[model samples]
Target: MKKFLSLILALTMLLSLVAVSANAEDITLDVIIAQYGPNTQEWFLGKGMDGSNFVEKFEAANPGIKLNLEVVSWNDLYTVVSTRISNNNAPDILNIDVFADYANEGLLMPVQDYCPEELYQDFFPSFIDQSVIDGTVWAVPDLASARALFYNVDLLQEAGVEKVPETWAELEDASQAILDAFGGEVYPWGIDMTTDEGQAAFAYYTWGNNGGFVDENGEWVLNSDANVEAIEYAIGLVNKGFTNPNPATQTRYDLQDMFAAGKLAMIIAPNQLPTYVTDKEGNVNLATAGLPHNEGATSSSVGVMDRIMAFKDDAAPDQAARNEAIGKFLTFFYDPENYVGWVSMEGFLPAVNSAVGALVEADPSFQAWLDVLGGAKFYPTTKAEWNDVKQGVIDVEQQALTGGNVKELLDALQAKIAGK
Candidate 1:
């Protein structure tokens, strides 16, 4: 009887161990984050997960929840995702800059289904509104940024300009004077008219002139009179020899490089630029301000936000378990103490309004950039066909820089985007 009882106990122990192993195996949540290169992963995710990191903390807080991360560079992410879709395999979570395509295709799950109501409400409405379409909030924004006017302070002073340009007239005057002073040595402006940058520049100028891609009622106003005036003004600067010789060929990155080397006097770029300029020792005396507007127009910057979207998988045996893990991770990720590291790492404005308020108090230099976001605007991100529309806008803007008619191009673009 003793021998039989001992054998029974051993079998019971073995059964318990197998059950534990099965539970552990199902706890892991797989995630994929987009990157431009391997270095971008390093910068965003840090060296490795440990006691001091987001992954470790999240795992510790939610016992049995292990995060498995995959980093895909931007150049290859789409191809990889498409192949995985063909196989009916998708990561539980994915990072995307533009979520509309995935949302429209039914590839993403509405974050609201898993995230808490209060937490969802905590995000800035402007940022959150962009992620919603047809009543579904498709993605949760993780980081954000806004545009600013960056200038070489030393160069501005050298050109006999007293203060940073505050209006179209001021900017033109500053550009002409700076060109006359640094003729044949430096370009007065580092204009980026390539497809990658032309649309953003156009947005700022259009908004600065009190015009926009869409009006308050969300109507297409790309070819409004104000936008026309803004475009003409920008082209006039180039025609009058106040900007780079060829604006159409240079990308924003190329212009940033020139600006850092002190070869270009001014440009409207993202707020992250000051650090890059300082790191290169390119211009220690650089200054940032709101991009200049027309005399009677309100100044506005373009706000940019990126998201982390959780995808629903019907094939998973325990979909609820996956959703719970996602909710827990997002809760931990956006907590002020934890989110600050990611925001600071990427040089972006905080998407959380509370965090933004906290940072504005903590860092004085950040205030100017944050202040400009009060009236910031975003592109027509909710449109399912925005990708094609955006490409059209880029093409026309680049064509305009290379001598295409501004009015004709914008009118055609407006019609095309409106499906006319």
Candidate 2:
């Protein structure tokens, strides 16, 4: 009897140990994020007490689940994410841009595997549509940004411009008057036409003129008459002394600083500028309006959105568990209350429809962004053609603005697209 009792006790102890091992395995997860530059990690986390508060809350709500965040410079992010994916060493969660090459490589897991269809149905269809590749939804939309006219209302009033321009002709006229009023002291308008941001700003002009990057068949259609006309209009602004002479040299932040200093009468930038334009003591008074279009044309801007992606790798132990953790974290992070904090604090538009309504109720200043969101359209996301398209637009626009022949530039662009 004593021997039998001892045997039973040992077997029970073995079972308890096995259970402990399984629970330990379930308590940890690895989440990686791409860091763009200096202090970018802080930006990702959020600002001040709000940021610290959220991090603590997230960890507490997810007890025993360890989150390991890695930060890499933008220059190194693509290489890092790619290498990890190639080796099947990808982290459980990662942040990626919508048009990145990884999406083209099919390295990401579809969000549909975890999220309910109805959860995403109410999101802006165009925004959600951009995430679909080969009929699989690879990521969840996080934040969105839209281009709008960032004008100094006080400066416009000083120049005797009674109202913001609603048409291209009026924009040109207002720009001329502002330039004349400010002389060499202030730039009438400043655009960063040399960078991707510049190209995006240029998209508005092309779209306003009834042009686009591709046709119904998805072939590049950049050299069309409407596109050339749009390019010409942008060049005209430069020639009329309405733009800063060396716009190609200015960074997006530099342009924003100039606007804040009242050195720029009008400019086109993302809806987030108000947060960056505070006064000497950190007060803010900047205002935003929609980008003007040609009369009888629809106005547009280059739209950018972010994605949270998961990677597939059979070697990663507990793949199912990690995916479950990610789904939970996203649900926590995207709660309407939490989302408002993230968007308002980070200067981004919310990804969920419910979050958008919550934000509008909380902050009236966001109304302009909400208004723009109602009409926003994304840039092309067909495939690897994005790099070629981006470079082509920049090259042609630079040539057209710098006294190069528009026709010759357009012809070359068409040839490049056809060759692609």
- Cα TM-score per model: 0.87, 0.84
Which ranges of candidate 1 are over 4 A from the true structure? 1-25, 36-40, 43-53
Residues 49-129, candidate 1: write the lDDT tens digits.
232555666777888788887778776787887787778888888877888877888988888778877778888887888
Angstrom error of the Cα, residue 362, model 2: value is 1.7
Q: Candidate 1: global Cα-lDDT?
A: 0.79
395, model 2: CA deviation in Å? 2.2
Q: Give, for candidate 1, the lowest lDDT window spanning 10 residues.
A: 43-52
Model 2 lDDT tens row, 150-223: 78877888888887887889898888778778888888777777664566755878888778777667677888
Model 2 clashing residue pairs (backbone): none
Candidate 2: list runs displaced more than 4 Å. Answer: 1-24, 27-29, 34-56, 71-76, 79-88, 116-122, 216-218, 279-286
Task: Quantify all predictions' global Cα lDDT against the true fold.
Answer: 0.79, 0.72
Question: What TM-score, to 2 decimals, does candidate 2 have?
Answer: 0.84
